[model samples]
Target: MKSKERAIVSLLCATTICVSWRGFRSCSPPQDQRPCACERCLSKDDPCFMKRFNKSVEPFLSANYNLSEDDFNWWKRLQHEKGNFRTFRATVARLFLVIPLSPDVLEPSPDRCRTCAVVGNSVNLRRSHYGPLIDFHDIIIRMNAGVIKGFEADVGTRTTHRVMYPESSVDLDNTTHLVLAPFKILDLEWLTKALTTGFKGRSYAPVMVLNPAFIRYVHHTWLENKGTYPSTGFLALILALHMCDEVSVFGYGADSDGNWSHYWEKIRNKKFKTGGHPGNTEYKLIQELDQQQKLKFYTGF
Candidate 1:
């Protein structure tokens, strides 16, 4: 080959080598191992806060009722320590951890906010025996799209804490209820609009809980603990189970008929559902808790 031709061929080979290396780096997937920054989990409550929380949570369970050491340890280990979780997919150099939150958050509300109830609109409430039982809770936390009117009167009306996404169907007024929304980037503009000009010092208090933290926490927990993050309904139920003393869960799950429908849907609509909040496995767990008498279900299912 001529000297000029040899130089050109060598140049082409070098270019090909660089291009292939770039492609290889780009195609490589991320690794699962990650630091416990909990940047997405929210509570970096520090060891002191954790120490205080532990002290209060442990003894409270033993004094209030019977909790075997194993059960208590299981609850503690599962909820507090990320060690109990399993890892999910790694994308963009991120590792998601999923841990099953302990049922221990049930021990008489560490802060004891008088009364709190977490409510969901399961078709079970169509039977309607929970109104009075619900009223007993001083603070009631109801979630997105849950019907306040047209269902049982007392079971829902006295709501103190109403949790809704920015796109939630429920309206917010000064006298209506406190709004707790988990934050979202997609919802950022609406959230900004709500705070700056829309909800501006509106009558109702607006509380924001970032969704990424919960999602990251739940995702991590799900990855580590097993199964989907226990449905939003079950999580809400679990939140209530943890926060309240005399708790009542009204309007959740389907009757034996497998007719999983809500009472407040458009008339004659059989296709109604709880949106994307949770699935059937969670619905069953709710029933299990009810049967154990850990919580009172007003659904009559």
Candidate 2:
């Protein structure tokens, strides 16, 4: 009689477990299993970043004007504390005072066209006579220590945005946007300190850091997370796609002699090439993009 009663209790417990599991499954469905959303979709379907792009110069159909609250949160969540003194979340909390959560919005213009010029530091730009054409673009994105003081005639001087790392950072006026592309957590801290407390006894002079989510997306989706990170020029190109409706690339690829050199620097015997970066692959990708008619590519003389 005791054994029968014990078996009855065991059966009841089993029945309760099954019912509870069914309830749990009903309450919590798998989010990943669901279909992709239109705006949030970062895959091939989205017209903006489609690899097979073939369109003329027009406004970005669905440009993200500025980073949203969710984008800021993603930064905090994705930044991992790997063998660090302070956690990423903790550091971000302290750094929030100086850094703007979202970048300045690119206001819609109904009258004028929004054109962009992505100027690379290739030696082919020398004597290219692209200055007049470059200045015509509404937005000009220059990366790293891309100086215009000496080479203004070749590569226009009117700079709307400058993208750089901590080492390559430069002082900007109130008009030009200093876009900081952070590689590590320290980069973010440096920006905050440089603007607020002054880094290394000097100031980076108040800047706007790029959205971490955008960086991650470019690294994983576009770059396939291959090397240490994507080049700043490549990053700038992706950024142009987001902001400008019509984009033009100038001063990319090697010179006629098949040498990689910057227009600003003098030519050297040894060919200048990318180190720790897939330059060949990147070049092919850029060529493909141009062939697709998404943008115009001017191979400078």
Best by lDDT: 2
lDDT of 1 by residue, 56-159 (tens): 22211111233343432343332243321121111101211111112122233223333456677666666565777777776677777777676655355776
lDDT of 2 by residue, 1-301 (tens): 9999999999999999999999986654344532321112123444645743222322111122333445444444443424242454455566666655545646434333467899998988888889989999888989888878878889987888888888887767667777877655787677667777655454332356665667656656677766555688887887786676667998777777777778888786665677756666667778877776656788887
Taken over the whole model, the C-alpha lDDT of each candidate is: 0.47, 0.68
TM-score of 1: 0.53
- Which regions of candidate 1 fall more than 4 Å away from where they truly are? 1-114, 152-154, 175-183, 199-202, 216-231, 266-278, 291-293
Residue 135 error, candidate 1, Å? 1.4
| Clashing residue pair totals per candidate (backbone < 3 A) | 15, 0
The prediction achieving the highest TM-score against the true structure is 2
Q: How close is candidate 2 to the true structure, as a TM-score?
A: 0.69
Q: Candidate 1: deviation at residue 267, Å?
A: 6.4
What residue pairs are clashing in model 2? none
Candidate 2 local Cα displacement, residue 236, angstroms? 0.2
